[model samples]
Target: MAAQTETVQWKLGEQLYQNPLSGEHDVSDFIMEGQAAISFPQRRMRMENVLDPKLGQQANFVFWCPVEFPDSIAISWDFWPIREPGLCMTFFSAKGANGEDLFDPSLAERTGIYPQYHHSDIHAYHVSYFRRKEADERSFHTCNLRKSYGLHLVAQGGDPIPSVQDAAGPYRIQLLKWKDEIVFKINDMIVFQWHDDGTAYGKRLEGGKIGFRQLAPMIGEYANLSIHALERG
Candidate 1:
């Protein structure tokens, strides 16, 4: 019913997928839904808005990896905050409510709209790790994990990433989903961990696509996306 309040020993299995995300070839198969510009000027994939920020929510977007991972896996990536004052999220275990592929043509149109992903026909677990958008959010920095077919805030933890002016460089971020539990870490420090009771959030999500989503006017860089099979030791 609960994780052992001690160091978790995981025997990571075969690497499922790996990408440097260094250039266009690495993401040639990726799908971008919304109006975001992507480039690799620094050998790292940079994401920013193509639309005017004054468009508000309409300027946001999601860039999705084409891989469909299994239920129990570890997703690891490197993150760099270039410019701030916007939210950044990672959506995993995303699929249609009835278990359709994330990009299925039958699925409702999604154009970086928040409600389209959370309130529409899809079910996903999204972690908002860099939340500095609004005035209140900037005042108190916290990483929030939400389960949706509805935006259900299930977990939260204090965010450790500093402001852009104070940020150092590529920070390692990892998200582990093994069975019914989820753990999020940054720079090898556990930011939050949660167990899904299932019934509370309808059902625990599993095995789907992973995507990077950014709110308007924010710029960020990403690299070294890797997913691995995980076994508890």
Candidate 2:
């Protein structure tokens, strides 16, 4: 029997029930109730999270957004870090026909696992997206600007952006598809594009739940407080 695909939708002021797969943490610590809103001029919803220093062992939070992609997916958000020298965001997903785990790598390779470094003054702003290929395969991509650190943006098989020498502040990221082409932008500046020739995943599976993440080893306070999903036409 073929697996069934589920489509989930959320509107302004609607609350997404925190799923048990939300890991072993309390839902109240990660997501803020009624914090998601829509931006009229941009025609897109905005998800925001403000970090509180007194929650959990670390000062960062994680949440999951359930989505079904028919043709493509696009995500945009604004991030600002209170400090200046730590990883700000790391995105993750579950890839498979029935949302099974396939690309499970060691904690070192996966960006979310906390590192053993300590810095109280680090901060970052990031945006990213992924293209599903099969049940066990997917392609990952991201663009980010850091304060007190150079901004880095890289596509699959491309070199990392040379470290910038100045601090960048409050950048917006947009990911969208124009026909069969995928594009990535930072503060409205187009930085990367690729043709959808169906080569996103080399040989793994595809099609499953997508999510947002913050890179671990983060000190100080950070939050992925609000998240939502919708199907694209």
Candidate 3:
């Protein structure tokens, strides 16, 4: 049988949200789960753990953009890995399993722990692009995409990012989600593409919120975060 392929047929429409994420006031209304020391040392938002790293997951945190986005959209941002021995993730299509707001007071409270997210009451798509937390990660770099309500890893691609020592970055991280397709790229280079059939990973995840999560002891700087609606060509 001939292999199948999907044609690229969508374009980014009007931007839904944009933030420099550069200074103190840029994130004034942002919501945070767990504890992190957020600063703007180089005019770029820097985040790291406040609790001792030895505390494990308790020392990690998630900073949310607070804006709910539609199912089809394009998200772009600039990133810099300052320090490692930790991991970073992007959470999207997130909401209470019963369709409550991600921050809905009625849902279970979350504090940046891994299980509290995957094994708990919410559903979200998680992508770990900068994964250097474990010994294996440091030795073999890979970008992973997982769907949750359960930690089901669905796609993976080679991570082309260099380690901190050799990284000279303002790496443009881009994610595009349209219908069932998810594409991830760095500096215009395609890293991976997955087409979700919906039923395989529970119900198809639609519109919800987006958040930036970091494991303890990792320091990263971010700027120019923007989201554009995905429109069919």
Candidate 4:
């Protein structure tokens, strides 16, 4: 007999029984480098930097999910870029350095700074898309995949999301990971794919949490977050 797998989903629209942007969902679940806000506007979960724009690089934050997921699964969500001048990143397969629960109070607190996630307490794979935050990024857009606990850029590809001014969308974004292979796509168009070498970037990450991070002065909306178990070959 084979192990049975199940799929979990969060229909983040306004009709959800539970508040997607509330404390129950671990909205304030992680530490922050600066102030950010979460709200349900127009039936979608919206995230934005609320601190003074002067904070600049200091105004970034990450919101983590309350539950941990299995290693092999497909994660998909809808994204809408409302305001720019910021970046968006998704962290998956994240766990404490000591294999402790991510929400374990005993673990060192996370303050949303870049180093804390990429060099300190946790290990995970992060993918950044819609890279319109900086001047160089705007001139040549691309999506990047990195393994963390020491920020290693594993892969990269062209970014297809347009700038805010001309954007009209609820773009469908999908991240499919199974064992050591990961693939990212936007609107069904493949952006990047990579097979983890396993030993090089520390041990392969498995069974952990996922998180949404944003740089200051940018606002983004999200909905229909879903996770599905993938059968092994």
Candidate 5:
């Protein structure tokens, strides 16, 4: 028999969710952790942790998308900072440590706490794009990329988005992961780029789920969430 090469079709990635962030979407559409609330304050999906800011760490919460995405995909969304002095993080490539589905009943239940996702049962890569939550973060603005199962700060770069006072935006944020390289950009300006050498934190993480996390008291509004595939080289 003659040897043949395999051919594959490449198309723009299938959109997982393009929510208007409006009230029309059901609350049942997402998996919630802690005390996160979704309200269409102005017909756009606005998420804010109901826990008081003074609650500090306990005030943090996460909202996970109902879909699992492939590795070589581009995750993009529009963000507006409604209230400041809060932190924002997006967790992706997440799954149970034992290779089980993220929602497998056998896994430990998640309660919107930080440790549950990082120290306990799940493994993921979370990026903080707008980090004005603390005194130090306000003085120095930067975007961070972290891999977890343990908090390993792999990359850091400047954050260009202005504070809520001077902001007039539905800022475009994008994170692109192709093979071992991950790049983050805001408004087309490259923030940080890192290549996983596969020696640290086991190996390059593969496909998993994505979630939105916020440190309470910071009301952030998001819309037009999407994921698209890149042509693999």
Candidate 6:
């Protein structure tokens, strides 16, 4: 298959967040700037919060890059935990041009991907993959990181993968598809693969925007983040 490549240097977005202080402070403390660093060991980009506390009410950091997929694509990010018990990442779709959620509350709730809090814990750290339903309200699929840190994939309509209790972290996750087979890999290790039979959810799996979601109890800081979209020719 033929493939294409694109590289993006992270930059400041149009929106930003601001904090209020009790009294007047030095002008330098009010200067805010967004910064990104690179780590060679992990081949990822680390983004830092550098917004001034007195400029705005909310911080909006957006990377508006367009990604086109020919067949299938693989997305990977190297995340270092800065806080515990938080959601380190999230993948969203821009299909709703009017700023509507592609996975509406109804579909998300029906597929068991809504609520967001359903998958949270102090020691939880794993990459998740799921396909949202555009037609049937009951169509969707999900894969989670087991307590043991092992990879667990499930077909919402099918049986779930028995949870394992192993420490699996600091590893890369790859989601790829070919013909009718979908594969999930960790650190280049094939953890799970499924036959994409002509099903409502599996058959329609293709193309989406990937983003990171940080949940509460902020246990650790996240750094060295990276995202790549590879298309098969």
lDDT of 1: 0.90
Q: How far is candidate 6 from the true structure (C-alpha RMSD, Å)?
A: 15.0
Please give the ranking of all candidate structures by lDDT, highest first, separated by commas. 1, 3, 5, 4, 2, 6
* Model 5 misplaced stretches (Cα beyond 4 Å): 1-17
For model 3, residues 79-172, the per-residue Cα lDDT tens digits are 9999998998999999999999999988898998889989999999989988999999999999999999889988888899899999999999
lDDT of each: 0.90, 0.32, 0.90, 0.77, 0.81, 0.31
Q: Please give the lDDT score at residue 160 for candidate 6.
A: 27
Q: Candidate 5's residue-wise lDDT over 136-184, tens digit each?
A: 9988999999888888888898899999998888899988877677778
Better of 3 and 4 by TM-score: 3
Local accuracy of candidate 6 as per-residue lDDT tens digits, 1-233: 11112221122222211212112231123212122121223333332323332322122122222332223444443334432222333342322323333333432221112223223211111234321212221143344432101222332222122111222344455545453444555566554555534342222333434334322222222233333334344
137-186, model 2: which lDDT tens digit per residue?
12232343211112323243221222122323334544443334444555
- Greater lDDT among 1 and 5 belongs to 1
Lowest summed lDDT window (length 10), candidate 2:
116-125
lDDT tens readout by residue for model 4, 139-177:
898999999888999889888999999888889898877
Worst 10 residues of 4 by lDDT: 1-10
**Model 5: lDDT of residue 101:** 82
Model with the higher TM-score, candidate 1 or 4: 1
The worst-scoring run of ten residues by lDDT in candidate 1 lies at: 1-10
Model 4 pairs in collision: none
Candidate 6 residue-wise lDDT at 38: 17
Range of the 10 consecutive residues with the lowest summed lDDT in candidate 6? 1-10
Candidate 3 displacement at residue 145 in angstroms = 0.3
- TM-score of structure candidate 1: 0.96
TM per prediction: 0.96, 0.39, 0.96, 0.85, 0.90, 0.39
